[model samples]
Target: MSTLGQRFSRWMQSRTLTGLTPGPHDITIRKDLRVPMDDGVDLLADLITPIGETDPRLPTIVIRGPYGRRGPVAGEARALAREGFPVLFQSCRGTWGSGGVFTPQVDEQRDGLATHRWVREQPWFTGSVATFGPSYMGYTQWAVAADPELAPDALCLLVTMPDFGAITWDNGAFALRNALGWTQMMDRMIRRDMLPLGLAMIRPDPKLGRAFGVLPLSDGDTAATGRAVHWYQDWVGHERLTDEYWTQQSHTASVPSVTAPVNMITGWYDIFLPWQLRNHAQLAAAGRAPRLTIGAWGHTSRGMGGVAVGEAVAFLKEQFAGVPSGRTALVRAYRTGEEEWHDLPAWPPPGVAAEAWNLHADGRLSTEPTAGGVTAYVYDPADPTPAVGGPSLLPNSGPVDNAAHESRADVTVFRGEVLTEPVTVAGEPVARIQFRSSQPSADVFVRICDVHPDGRSMTVCDGIRRVVSDDGFDEVTVSLWPTFHRFDAGHRISVQVSSGAHPRYARNPGSGSPAFDAVTLHRAEQEISHDEFRPSFLDLPVWAG
Candidate 1:
């Protein structure tokens, strides 16, 4: 390696990837080796190995994803190779220089299994193997981990889940921005439009907002990219989780059966946190010891990537080289408001008690239930309530001040008194709204925020639920994302009730029609009752510890 390159690597380890020990070996990258699959189509992969290691003793690390094998992924491969592990970084089908047509999640299973088999058949096969990557690459790892015969020796998954269908239709509402934004991103990547892609990642395209506003989501793909994206359209068409298309696309059924040593890393603001935690829980329930680490970051946070790589290297070394993992606990999570890291035995640790905070008509939130009263708002599909900040694929993701959004007329705000003592929340926050809509179909978007003394209301966690109820009033439960936050003394806990979080979740047309084909917009008069008979409240997972 050149002196400059070596210096950069040392800087990255000491600063960005802190706590990880830099390796001594220099690396060589063997490019464009073809591995044949079940259908006789060859997938191109690059192998990175230590320069002096002709016979590699450590387990080979495999990374497969739709993203090209160069750039950040290649850097990770080289880092692993320098650590004395041979790394096979392969492009997914039809991506980069690979052969077969790309179909996202549908092809990962067969392709991953075939690649693992091919690795074992190679002359330099090390018998043991591991898979590592973040996001889509993590899904690729889960794709083959279910099969005991084909599963890798270890898996390092970051901010990803097995079921794409769940994220597509989270809380029974379409994840419009994330789903569509991801489609546009992959479209640009497949075309090798690096400049625009890089620009979009840094800041969302302003023109893309107009495309997202287009009626009938089937046209959204073309409007955003000037071409029809097959996967986006397919996702829109199969909005229901029970649909056969989504069933074929999901690999969640594989989680409990995975026998590999697993290390999962995610952020509280990450798109896949909830589902990934569920996967960890499933593995734990099945007697598998999967390690989980969560940070206070968004999907696109630079810190998230750095933490993932550092943790993954430690996990790989522990599994393959008999090295100490150096992990403090089975579950390590960073508490946001407190700004402290906690090592726990498990997620939501024991003794978390649920506290009900009642919502009053005069925008007051208290523990005491109010008498009969209701608050109403008008939600127009033509001018949907815009999303401020939360889990999203765009650059402006994670916790942002939501004061402006709360000031909007379409959203109802409920504020609690300034806290005299600190209140820590450690699990999922759920909202139960005794809701009624003028239209048969409507959506209820609920959010939890921490109001600082300076008047900044930063979003903590939120969720949306689409409802179609014929009953006069339905108690709709919206389960917000799990969070670990401390509302310090003098800070207030607030909640926002709205009909839509616009581009984050697709707007409900209020005409009892699917968002995919609904072009007719109807204004919805939504009501939330705080009546004793139909009490609406926010259930907080209050951690007394």
Candidate 2:
């Protein structure tokens, strides 16, 4: 280690985790230890270990990510270490005290393997290894698992995407809100060391209203970051989902090859919920089955890990001791509206079937197709429909009431009669619309809500489809985020149809003009036509068994 590294390690050893005490064991904090890489660079890591355990070599767990290695996870690491297990908390190759340039989603395999190798070399390390963390940390665990030579014995992952494109190009529209919010935070993290306190103290969410409103999205990165975030700009520059840029950065390509058992934890309204849920099916298709639990929460549900850590430890202990965990089911999903957890044998719960509730012309949804007409609205780019609540990373994002946005003229809502009995929807919801747009291009934003007896409609989930084909008409399928919800007696179900969701998805200017750059704003005349001949409806996943 360099003199600076040595001094930093000494300083780290003396430091206590802010607002948290050390664990119950005679714990030792060895910080800033350098793990050597193949190319002669060393990455920084900290170890929390028990001082006087009977075993000289102990089973281990690792958490690696770009964020500060010791800030949020240190307490968790200490606690795990006190349970007679070694915990390794390491910064990714580039970030914090590590010795590499910071890049996202592209460099975890080599560094992850190096850290695992470093751990095995320690006198206190056992042969068995496991990995656990959330978000980017969870991603790092997956990235590392891609390597057969370095796969951990078990995994505990939370709230992460299978591929980067899911967040970059969600359901065919640019994920403007998520990209902007995340990159802005990263910009601050990168600059804090070099900037003076006066200059460094950027607000956590600095003027996102103005930043995301910038046109020609190429400039949006500079507007949000004060300087160009190359990755953000790269995402903006490559707007197509079919672009090779997204495919090259995808981690899903290597996901199926991983053989270790995985424990996945996620939120119902998490920003990555769509992609994370997709991963479960993907894994099953690839002959790998992972344990899962989805909760009723949003993106920043880190505290959920506490209850889950015990489960992780139990799983790891079983794996480390050559015992298989006799888990029967594949999923444990939380029912949101009812606020209850349901242990299931499979996703979509065995016999759940789709029930098409037909969209009608008289501003009502019914089981029978009895009406024929069109509900039309003019979508103005200048006054686009605002995104209220759904699966987003923004403030106040989740299952909030949608009454405020429902009143907008550009938004058309179709209501259903009050249900005499309870209706439980347990999986993905699909909206198949037989529609037309006056302009050459447009967007269809669809949302499902549960209307209380008193008429308060709370959003369940939403989706958007950008249509470029204006061939007189088209049928667009908008897949809403999956949910475990129940509409009780006297409550009604409704669908909110609109042309845009504003910054959550980049608004369609309705002109077929170049992506998000065109200033030519066309007032799109939107129409939803449903009749006996042409029926538009919502295919809700009604639980059958």
Candidate 3:
């Protein structure tokens, strides 16, 4: 290592993660090592190794992703190398200096297995191999997870899901902002355009916002990136999970087949939390001991990144080096509102009980169902309800005060009495609504917020569903994101009902036309009924112990 790189590593150890013990060895990086694939395409990789280590049996941690190898993952690679584990950080095909056309999630299985086979033949390899990284890197790990002969010895996945298609068409509604924003980001990165990426980090870019509002969602890629993106076009075109296109790109079927020890970390406001939890639950149901940690963060929260690195280092050390992991339990979750961390034997800990809070016509929430009426709102596609704060790729994501959003005419608010004591919610919250729309199609967005004594209502978790029914009322069950939040004393629990959270989710055409192809805009008159026969309520998983 050069003097500057050595000094930087020391600085990172001191400032970034003070709790971790400094590794004993100096690190060296070998740049641009070309590894040939099955079809003779060469993928670029950088091998990070300890300078003078004699232990050739130490494990190698392989991290693969489309992002440049020297980006954010460099710190993680160097950290592991310093601790005596060799690190191979490879760029996916068609990214950076790698060969082949870039098609997300398609080439990973073949490319990853080929890379691992090459690693085992290297002169420095003699021990078990583990795969580590976050987001798309996690996807790369899952892509080869079911390979009977090439499965990794261990996996460390953070803030990612296996089914990219499910996240693309979440709840049967197109994920406009996330899908388009990510496409634009990758396009900019590949073309080396840094201005927009820099501006997006500090504030929302107006041009990108305009791109999200473009009609015929198929044109969004061109509006955002100045050219049509093939992946983005395919994402918008495929609307069903049962499609063969989606199945070909998905790795969800590999979860039950994974036999390696696993560690997963995610955030409360992450777009992939629901599916990530599903993977965790699947592993647990099969009697696999996978460790999981959930933090109070958005997808891009800096805090989440810091925590993930620490957790990964500890878990990898425990698995490969026989080190004692200091964790108190199998699962660790951060509780919002109260801002406390709880360690438990499992998630949705055993003491949770479902409690129903009835919604009244007068905008009051109570335990007892009473005589109520319907609340109506008009949702105009031209000026759809705007997204305030939730799971988004932008910097403005996470829990934000929704006071202004709640005051909009297109939104309906229900409030419960101030809590005299803290009410802790530990699991998923479901919203059961009796809804009807004037048009053939509409969307129902339900959000749960904690109203502070100072009148600031901050979002906790929310869910959206695309509805298609006749003019009469139809029962809709919108399952919100699972949460661990506390409603503090003197704070009231609030629920916001609206037709759309524009840009975050594509606007429902209300004419039964596909959002990506629709040219006609129809205004939808939406109704939420809370009566004796069709009572609307929120079912919360309240912890009883």
Q: Tell me, by TM-score, which candidate is best.
A: 3
User: What C-alpha lDDT values do all the predictions have?
Assistant: 0.87, 0.76, 0.87
Model 2: pairs clashing at backbone N, Cα or C within 3 Å: none
Candidate 1 accuracy as lDDT: 0.87
Could you give candidate 3's per-residue lDDT for residues 355-411 as a string of tens digits?
A: 999888899988887597988999998998998878876544679999988999999
Cα lDDT of model 1 by residue, 297-399, tens digit: 7776766656677788778777777688788789999999999999999888777999999999999998987887889999998999998878976545778
Where's the lowest-lDDT run of ten residues in candidate 2? 13-22
TM-score of each: 0.96, 0.89, 0.97
lDDT of 2: 0.76
What candidate 3 gets wrong by more than 4 Å, as runs, is 12-22, 54-57
Q: How many backbone clashes does candidate 3 have?
A: 0
Best-first order by TM-score: 3, 1, 2
Instruction: Give the root-mean-square deviation of each candidate in angstroms.
Output: 1.9, 4.8, 1.7
